[model samples]
Target: MITLKNVNVNELESAAQSCDFILPIEQTAVWASYQATIEGRKPWGCFIIQQDEKPLAFISLIDFETHGYHYVRSMHGPAWLEHPTQELETQVLQALATQLKQADKNLVFMRVDTWYDNLAVPVLSTVPYNQTVIISLEGGYEEILKRMKTRGRRDVRKAMRECPATCMDETERAYNDFSEYYEVMVDTGKRDGFVPAPLSDYTDMLGALGKDHCRVFAARVDERVVGWSIITMHGPVAVRYYAAMRSDAMHMFVTDRLLYAECCMLYDLGVTHYDLMGIGNDFAPSLKGLNVFKTKFSTEIIPVAAGRDIPLRPVYYKALTTAKKLRKVLKH
Candidate 1:
């Protein structure tokens, strides 16, 4: 029988390390702590699932509320410790939904963010992009460069040689330098047609995650910041969660150099995988512009499982869905 047991962060982290499972940064304890810093979000719990006393998977969840409806979200989990089959995933989700509902009467649903592939279940809200580019950081810096596309390699070299931009780890000075990064982010969002998150969101994230798990890399020309990338690390994986560059500095290829330098730094820290986060695909065409930039760093695009919302209260969930649709229509 499959059972979900509550565990602490250290226990869960240790299990993942012992099993050699790559725990996503979003599912880490640090991420839960970061979520706690955000309003309307709370660290629910960390859990380990077992089948007949053998550990199967681990997940950390955060509780959130939307329009007065409470829900718990598991981001990039449950990370399986053993080889997972569809049957196992189905069983696990079913069991998790039931258990979570029993634990919190106010929770209307549970959102399971995908880390697996081809989940045969209905998803109310899908991930922004179900596919992403992952670069293996196993080999040395030169070997890592060899895996990049020709354009990527040339851009990095040219950015280093011709551009006066210098990239360095600025995590220690993240507070002092964050204003510059945020200014660039706001400009990038305006240029890209998206709204950037509030300043406190990024600041709280950096403060909560700290320097050990999060690093801020900045590319500067003449001592002025031109680009920035925020990387989050957990176990053997490092994810580039946020990146932005000044519109005026685009010609210098600062971002290209910044990411390459970040990858090298991660590799040196014993990180095995560098996730460039989401990329545009046929299903998520809105993000296609990201493909031109992110794909240059890696040769392969990885398809992962998408998120699913398992409703515990059917009537309430239906009402919530209708209200959400109405809001969208009203906005338009």
Candidate 2:
């Protein structure tokens, strides 16, 4: 029988370090703490899924509510320690949902971001794009540049020659410049037709992750900050979490230089892979521009598995789903 054994946050971190596959930042304990800082979210502790005392996977759950209906979510996880077939995944998820329901009668469903190309089980919603670009940082800075497309290489070189400087700041003092970065993000959202998260969200993320694992890189021209990016490190990999630039500075290609510098810095820090995050997939047509921009840095695109929601209370889950659809339609 499968059982969920609760563990402390430190235990979760230690387990993640020794896990077989790379765990997403969202699955980390630090991320759970960061989520707790956001309003209307709560950390439900970490757990180890075991069958007959043999450990299978570790997952950190976060509690969330939508339209007064509470649900549990595990983002980009149950970081499996060993490869499992689709049947195993389905069994584990079913056991997890059953265990979770027993623990919290209020939970209507369990949302999980599984690392599978497909699943036999039912899912409430399908992820449109599970693909992202990853750049290898193995062969040093010059080799890294050689791997990029011609346009990416040219832009980096040009920006390096023209920009005053590009640097990564991981010091505690760097938090002081967050307001300036938030301003750029606000402008970026307006220009891109998306809403920016509150400044506190970003600030809390940096704080929760701490300076050793997270940092900000900025590109400047004549002492003025033109572009900036936030990166988080885990084991041998680093992820580019967020980035924004002053719209007028697009011609300067500061973003290109900024990311190049960040790559060099991560390589120097012993990171083997740099994940540029999501890009356009067939389902997400709106991300085409993002695909064009991110793919310039690396030709390699990795496809990940989609997320699934296992509903325990079918009636409430159906009601919640219908309400969400109605809300989206009303907004449109």
Candidate 3:
């Protein structure tokens, strides 16, 4: 049997504290780091899955208002074993659809951005489609880097030679550089036709990470800033969460050296695997330069298989996605 209910802050926090996979985004640690911490108040929940009343898994989703519509963020979970039967996933999602409807009878639609593959269930009539990335982190970072093309290695070395960079864990004031990083991200997003996450999101992450759970690594050119990346550590995995470079100097490979340093620090921190995050595969699926940038420092590209979206109300899901596309257009 499956059940979903909006629990209180204490219960929500307890379930997260007990999670086994240590999902970097979904874990309790991140909520504090980014200051996006949630309680049973407003639109937040700890949806539980069980077997004979024994909790088998939990999905930590943040129910918040975005652009005036209800959205759910998968901080982590549907946490499960290596492989669960198709029937099991169906039950999980059905429970979710029921819960989402209960929470927001007035809520038009709810969106979940999960970075996990195969966790999606066709039984979920509430989701239209999932958009996100899930990179595998099952090996040592250096060995993965070695698998990159010869050109990738050269850029890594070139970035090292050209930039005077210093990489380390984040400090209280590290977010000051978050601005420089965000600027370049905005520029990149515009070029690619997407908007970047707001500054509040970074601060929320920092507050959630506090000083102990996450680290921000940066690259500087002669006391002038060039590039930066954020990594969150949970269990044995280190996720390359976010990164950016100075628009003018990106061609100089500062981003490469910055990543190399991040890998080294992860090794020092005793992490076994690193997540390269996301890469798009369409039209220019094998986009030479961007692919070269990430693969050079890592070889493993975990195929995210395919995504599954469940829509509780098929009609609403269609309208929501359409409205979303139109909204993006009006913003620009």
Candidate 4:
């Protein structure tokens, strides 16, 4: 049953708003359109799933090809309007599987990173994510500070006293000019032992989203850039996507001030939630430091369902899983 028929990217507002887990920026059409603008990759599509003429789910797929086989990745979605029963979810997954198989004989697998917790259909594999942190910006600035950890509040006070934070000009030049911020991001990635995105990628992302949807905040100590962040404000939520700080500025608490300033900025613009992005599941060692920093100001931790891979071609799926295991061993 095509409960929802031929729902295009432009027609995603109603579907996206129906689901609590699906943020406005995370709408299938928005991401698929952005991906298409990029140079590489395969065909992609955006669709909405409905029940009883009411939108229930939204998914965007990228038909990636490798070794003569095609696999679909539903980016951060198949987000639901509400908690789905196991039977309902299974039927939806099966319907999707049948549809993809008939559309492309070479299709081997469909991978989904479901949002929220539900009994999704069993899959070949799962990708885990740490619980995420979010802060409600509804109570206004003073109420926001009142919810922060005592130490966090103290640091913010110190940061204000020592080094103030400010948003750069909300102009196209600041958004496109990645020269200064890119350097800090590289240094931060090396210090944190993670790879940073290339300058071209940021340029492309800002260009696609435009200055109205994205903004950059910078912290300074006596005219020197100490910390910076790139945030996206879409729908009702604002996410601090990329952030970096100078190693020397850590003790100065520049990062704290930068984050607080951004929250205020978003609040002024009527955004109600601030997502600190990904964090450890339970203060795990891997992200202990990062988690500690975000937890200080977070209202709660939200655990979203991770990615799962379902096989359309069982034999090829086995081979792919085997290769993945082998690669992991080789890396070790």
Candidate 5:
């Protein structure tokens, strides 16, 4: 029997660090790395899948009142990837829905853009809200790069020639994008209204992910860091979770160069694809340039569905959504 319940930070650690279904996105380090960065998080429903009292799957749920929806992150495989079948998936999804349905009424529905490939469910993109990207590692690094359009290689080379950089290996004493890497991100986020998670979130990550799958790359001029990239590994994918560069760094193509270097490193490590986390082409007009840039290297666009929401109590869902909307207007 699969029993579901809320998990603590320690329990999250167990699910994230396990060897069976271990992946970077699920790693406590990767999640905590973005701690202070995102806001409006609810912690009650980070559900763990257990079979016979042993954890076998892990998934997180967030109740977002702005849209009156619940977002499900990393919703598969607290167990071995091969463990969940079509029937079990249905059961698990239903079970997860039951948990969220009990929450406030504001939750209109559940939108689950899970870790599973966009291809896994062909019709998912047709849903109300969704975003995702596909990656390729089928060929070795050289081959993948060769597959790139000319501009892709050109930006990479240009960045390399001008960027000052090196890898802060995961084991390198201690450093973080939230602290050591804050400047570049700050400059960029301030340009918008974005804020990252607090610093303490990353402190928890260092202990959880260990040194094997996390890294921070800083682009510096002389001794000054102009930009940095924080990335984590999950299975065969090396995801670029956060990145930004200073005015000079951006012009010098330092940020792009850093990513190119990561691509090469990932290739050497036998990792196949480098996921440039996301480029909200649909919502972030300011990022149109980046969306265009990422396309130069990516072979295809993978659409991810919105995280699904199901409130345990219909009334609570209504109230939550109303409160959320009111709060948004007040802030504005």
Candidate 6:
């Protein structure tokens, strides 16, 4: 029989590192702290799945309430030490459901966006999904650069020679220039036609992640911040969690140069893998431009598992689904 035990944040983080999972920034305790501190979403629930008292997997989740129902979400996790068999995976899911329902009588569902793609599940995903590019930082700088596409290498060299932007890491300081970063992100969103998160979210992120797990960098030209990158590290992997470059910076290729420099910097700091997180899959036409830019730097396109929403209260789940559909239709 599978059992789930509640774990503290440190235990959760340690398990993730020990397992060497390709955890997204969202899945870390750093992110949980940020969500709690900034978004008022607490207390974080970390669970360890066990069989006969031996730990099998670790999962960190958060509680969210909508329309008078509470739910749990685990982003890109329950990472297993060894890949679990299909039967074990299903058993774990059922255990979680029984445990969560017992803990919170109002719990309606549990949604998990897993890291392992092949893990089979009984239900389809209720969340949007995207593919991401992973670049191994295994070798030296030259070797790493050599692994990029020829066009990417050319662009990096050209950008390095021509752009001449200054890079600054502000990980040690509180992110006071979030307004400036948000401004650039807004401009980028407008040009790219995607909505940007509010400035406060970034402020919370910086505050929560702090210097140890997070690095905020800026590319400056003429003393103005033209591009920014918010990078987060978990275990040996680092993700470019959020980045934005002004349109003018794009013209001069400052964005490319800054990104290359940052990757090198992270490599030197002992990060073994870097993710240019979230590119469009074959299904997303809108992600073409973004995909083209990121794919140039990637050695591999990683497939994350499909998200699954397991309903504790089937009637409420059906009602919520119908409500969401109706809302979308009415808005349109």
Candidate 1 per-residue lDDT, tens place, 1-332, comes to: 99998987767888877777767878777787889888999988888888997889889888997667788888777877655787788788878877887888999888775544433235556545689899988888998889999888888888778777888888888866578789989999998888999988889989999888888989988888889988888778888889988899988777778888888888988988998978777757777878988898788999866666778887888887788689889999
Could you tell me which 10 consecutive residues in candidate 6 have the lowest summed lDDT?
118-127
Candidate 3: tens digits of C-alpha lDDT, residues 127-151:
2222222223335555535655577
Stronger candidate by TM-score (1 vs 3): 1
The best-first sequence of candidates by TM-score reads 1, 2, 6, 4, 3, 5
Which candidate has the highest TM-score of all? 1
lDDT, candidate 3, equals 0.58
* Inter-residue clash pairs, candidate 4: none
lDDT of 6 at 115: 38
Worst 10 residues of 2 by lDDT: 117-126
Q: Give the runs in model 6 whose Cα sits over 4 Å from its true position.
A: 13-28, 115-127, 172-174, 282-289
Residue 238 accuracy (lDDT) in model 5: 76
lDDT of each: 0.82, 0.78, 0.58, 0.70, 0.56, 0.76
Q: Give a tens-digit lDDT track for model 6, residues 1-332.
A: 68888888678777666665445567666777777774435654888788997778878888876557677877766767777777778788878888888888877888875533332233333333557788888886887789898878899999988996887775654366578778889998998888998888888787788777888888889878788899988768888889888987788898778878888888888988888867676644446667778888866787665467788888888887788778889999
> Which candidate model has the greater TM-score, 5 or 6?
6
Error of 6 at 99 (Å): 1.4
- In candidate 5, what are the lDDT values of residues 1-332, reduced to their tens digit? 77786876457656656645554364343454344244554433466766676766666544333343443333322333344555666666667666665554344455554434221322212222234343565667566667666888777767666555654333363443346556666677776567855556554555555556666666667767777666677667777766667765566777666666667666767677777755555533344555776777765666543333443444655676677678889999
The residue pairs in collision within model 6 are none
lDDT pick, better of 4 and 6 = 6
Clash count, predicted structure 6? 0
Q: Show the lowest summed lDDT stretch of 10 residues, model 3.
A: 123-132
Indicate the residue-level lDDT of 294 in model 2. 91
In model 3, state the lDDT of residue 96: 79
lDDT at position 210, candidate 3:
59
TM-score of each: 0.92, 0.89, 0.73, 0.85, 0.66, 0.88
